[model samples]
Target: MSSAGGPAIGTITTEVPARLDRLPWSRWHWMIVVGLGTVWILDGLEVTVVGNIASRLSESGSGLPISDSQVTGLGAALYVAGACSGALVFGWLTDRFGRKKLFLITLAVYLASTAMTALSFSAWWFFLFRFLTGFGIGGEYAAINSAIDELIPSKYRGRVDLIINGSYWLGAMGGALLSVLALDTGIFPENIGWRLTFALGVVLGLVILLVRRHVPESPRWMFIHGQSDGANAIVEGAEKEIEEETGAPLPKAGRAITIEQRRSISFVEIGRTLFRAYPKRATLGFSLFIGQAFLYNAITFGFSSILVKFFGVSSGTTGYFFAVIAFGNFLGPLLLGRLFDTVGRKKMISGTYILSGLLLFVTAWLFDQGWLNATTMTVCWCVVLFFASAGASSAYLTVSEIFPMETRAMAIALFYALGTAAGGISGPLIFSGLTSSGVVSDAVVAFCIGAALMVAAGVVAVLFAVDAEGKSLEDIARPLSQRTKPTGRPAGPPSAPAV
Candidate 1:
């Protein structure tokens, strides 16, 4: 094996990806899940806490002079803007650098910015750090998703990815409950509670950073970047460790692939690979992302307002309702994720999206008719989101896997930024305006729009979703650095199967 800093520029053939995919589930895989996947939970906690605390922050003696509208509207917008900007910048960097390096740096950024947010004494300071905090979390989406897809076995990839993405709701659940306690006047003073919430995020981030340190970089990344010896060492070590842990002989790895290794891929090549080389896939990615983004933003941004205004549910108790809905979101992926792997991606992705959209249409009709109360409305959202969350989580999985390995991180970043922008910006603006209008019909229109978009995306899924369940990443989309075998044509899309 070569040294860690050995040459990173040559063609080499290796079965690193095959070896990784063929391994039996083991303790080491769990370590990767805990180390890498937990970041989503932190993100959920960050976004949720800010939202729940917005009203408190706008109050007298809360220390900041920000209004409720400023905290919820402008601050939220800046945070999302920061996240989109960060994803694009760090995503490109993650593709350029190794996953381990970028993931660590992104997490550090989250910790530092969030920690500073806890100390903010002014509105500008608070808003600036919120954006920076989002910046760090945005980078995590690209780096972590790429690493997780590359590292996880193909058989378990669909469920694992969905669950990891879905874990954001788990953090949302935590944040919802945490805010209830944080905002309690008996437990904490108004000014102190909000600051402590941000501090807790920093504490959680620090722990995640510690666990993440032990996780290794993607070996597939190493081999393609001309670190073949290091790649082989890592794979071989994993194979040996899994065998010992599982107490069984391991299966032989599948076929080896040759590559024309390089240190980096240019944005021009990345663009061509996504648009020109795989235009259908680019469309699929956009459809899935936009659909899910709008629906989530519509419901989440308007959820509390709807309860308070239409149903007369008190603002103080909205957290309890949100926690229930968040739990439903997490459960969707946990219960339905295995089906995506077993039933196949096309059928499952489309089914979930379509099902959720149909359910939302019914909910909208019921809301417009004034036949539902707060409890029933919450139940309706819980049901609708049960399917929507699973479909939404699959969007990330689809984009990450369908692109070439060289563009994996950037693809995840681009789709995320686009989806988040579309949904995060438009969903909130449209839904908030509708729900706050004190007209039930207006809010119903917003819900219908979200539902219609979701249904349309599902229709697209039925037409274009890739049948990627249990397939090798190399088989789904061949790496750009890969070399064709003697007498074989140059690499294109995998001819194995289609949706």
Candidate 2:
């Protein structure tokens, strides 16, 4: 066996990963998708409400005395900063503990923070709660993306991930509509209405938490952690259920890789793995994430203000515009996600990015010429974001799939932290300042900057995008515990370790 104090570091061979990858798509899989995937919707809901309510929050009696810029600019930045912090901290914990455990805990954190945000009577309290809410969402990203990649079949991974991540817009749509109703003076008072909007998030989070409780721990994770029996039980149960549902014989499972089970991996090792072993991919992840982060944050957080300042749209009416934009973002992934797997990741990613950037540039020109009113401006946003949303969703799919399983969560966290810090935190602030200036030229400059970033990221994707479609995770990146490193390993079935 092994020494007690040294940690149980020994090789164990298992087919859990292969078994999971080979299973047919069934209702059981859909359950996992819906239960675990709803976190994105909650995030979308949170962000959309904040953006839509920025104008209302600055009113004389809206509880918080913050200016419109503070709500959309500083407030958005703080939320992103908190998300960055949470991703790093919780990402490490997820890899150390388990996906199911961290996801549950993270959602609870979100529920508590969001509920308390509704009770805030001051700027500091509201800002603190918003940060906390962001912390929960950031943690959810790491845990959820890791678990989804581990459990979903390789063939369907790309589409599934895109659709799930894109569902954030579904929540955005809901928030846009809800805020419209909530902000109406006839439906609710100014002070009470905004508070009620946040409180509704608590109710949604509670329902999602109940659904998440039933989602089992990742079997691949269990086996890696040395619980082979537990892993086998989970996979077997899934196979049986799928087979019975389909009324067909299941195919033989793929080969299994042998791994030396380690109780925990250190931060230093994780860093080395990212920077040293996968430097090119690290660059790719950063490029994809930052580009999308800047474009999305700038537009989403500041869209309402642009409507008010440039288009003379009322705060209450901005939700209808946002709802239309949200629908476009949601449909991008729904309509185009299959291409990432079928047509290949590189082409689709690059095409979407570049096309979206061009559209943004054209829209900027139109806005500068003063040829577009509120309706036309929103349509332009919808078109640009439709393409950008799908491309951004692919960014997450790329980072999650290209790295080794051991460092999966941390890798995602690092890119998200870096990208969000670089783009997300600054995008809103910059755009808010530009939009608040009420100068079309300044807004045009901001749009140009976002467009340039997206185009540059597209070029990077063409240069470094990994050809990972329809391939198993093991094929893409070998486990760190393997006897052979990824570069030296040949294309063949994995062999069992000597007992």
Q: Specify the highest-TM-score model's number.
A: 2
By lDDT, the best candidate is 2
Per-candidate TM-score against the hidden true structure:
0.94, 0.96
List candidate 2 stretches off by more than 4 Å. Answer: 2-9, 484-499
What's the distance in Å from true for residue 397, model 1?
Answer: 0.2
- The lDDT values for all models are 0.87, 0.89
Alpha-carbon error at 482 in model 2, in Å? 1.8
Model 2, global lDDT: 0.89
lDDT of 1: 0.87
**Candidate 1 at residue 136, lDDT?**
96
